[model samples]
Target: MTTYLPKDVTDGLHAARKQDMARKSRLRVEADGRSFAVLRRWQGGFAVDASVVPPLRGLVDLFEGSSPIASCLIIAAEAEDGEMHYEFKRATAMRHSAPLDFQKDDDAPVALIGQ
Candidate 1:
């Protein structure tokens, strides 16, 4: 499903782009090991315009091509303009190459200790 991001987030993304030195990279999203496209991306979060099989609730990985960039939590999901929109928060690197699983289970969700 398609998601719409907040104005401030979009504005920041655009502002970053206007700066010449910032790394301009679009991310590919993965939910529970399944690859998905990041239709829109920013520093804070991104959106995927496809159905989240069984629905996503926890971690979502952001990749730059094959390299893992960040792992975010799927904080909220809702219908926007006849599509499911997933909202994520800034990711935490729990461990290198961790599966970035989104399952809410006994295991603690990956988080960055000491901001």
Candidate 2:
């Protein structure tokens, strides 16, 4: 059985705490062309500290560049650390589906039959 020195134990604890804090580092989250700093990231989705804008209840499309990556709904919001903790889910976009176009193009060339 190996014995760890007191200083070594303290250093190990400090290192573990620092790693945990790093996991909670600020992350950028964009929605509707606006970006917010997220406080923490977990499985499924992340949490944002929205102290500037009032939290709203509805579905929001989160985008990366010009393409949308996630569709999240504002599930819960609470006041914490002088800010609103907005939690969202990485859910699918619930919208009406567009009807399929079945009309053929007039400019299309027809293939020769039995040629």
Candidate 3:
């Protein structure tokens, strides 16, 4: 885990808690959770965090808009194996069918593709 001073930790938590749901970290919103930037927005349904931006922006078309955890590549869930696993809904911009729920699915994705 990353260690920080009491003030730093407190400030970080406060900032994270203030993030928006629109996936725009740079912009402030009234959402209840942290919103990563928009990596890309799909046609049918789905969106993901902008973590893979810059390096992968050219490869995947990260658009604007919010996609649910079920559709975006934001979080990863692991079963009872003590091993890391990604959510079934987790997929690249091209493979999403819906949006992932930000409330229930807050974990980030374990892996990125086409980088």
Candidate 4:
């Protein structure tokens, strides 16, 4: 005989799976001093747990652990399946400075073998 799980049980399982994936992801979102785990991300948009924060809009920052990844303008937000998906009006990547070794002082004189 074939058997199927109840709707609530299946929903719970799906929610658990989403939570697990978010926990494992290094990506996170920050807005108004609040941080939320990213459920999914792409070039145009991202998703976060709806239970954590209220509906998001306007500017928000994306981060990979402690590093800033991008500045996104959330033009739209939709909540579904316990997750809030945001569509960005614009997503600008953060610029990082070069390593100390890679940077050179142009005014500094070069060393010579014999002077």
Top-TM-score candidate index:
4
- Candidate 2 local distance difference test against the native: 0.57
For model 2, the stretches where C-alpha displacement exceeds 4 angstroms are: 1-35, 64-67, 93-115
TM-scores for the candidates: 0.47, 0.40, 0.19, 0.78
Ranking by lDDT: 4, 1, 2, 3
Residues 11-109, candidate 2, lDDT per residue (tens digit)?
687566544543555454555666655555555555554544445456666544445556777666566544455566546743456655787689966
lDDT of 4 by residue, 41-102 (tens): 88779888777767888999999999999998896567888888889898888989754766
After TM-score superposition, the amount by which residue 107's alpha carbon in candidate 1 deviates from its true location, in angstroms, is: 42
Model 1: how far residue 25 lies from native, Å: 8.8
Off by over 4 Å in 1: 1-26, 51-54, 93-115
Give lDDT per model, in order: 0.61, 0.57, 0.35, 0.86
Instruction: Please give the distance, in angstroms, between residue 59's alpha carbon in candidate 2 and its true position after superposition.
Output: 0.9
What digit string (tens of lDDT, one per residue) describes model 1 on residues 1-115? Answer: 7699999998687555433222343556677778765655655555544343345678887787787777788765565532346666657754565575576778766886895
Off by over 4 Å in 4: 1-3, 98-115
Better of 1 and 2 by lDDT: 1
- TM-score of structure candidate 4: 0.78
- Residue 46 lDDT in candidate 3: 27
* Residue lDDT tens for model 3, 16-113: 54344333432211122333353223443223332322212111222334433322333333322122222324345344556666556458676788
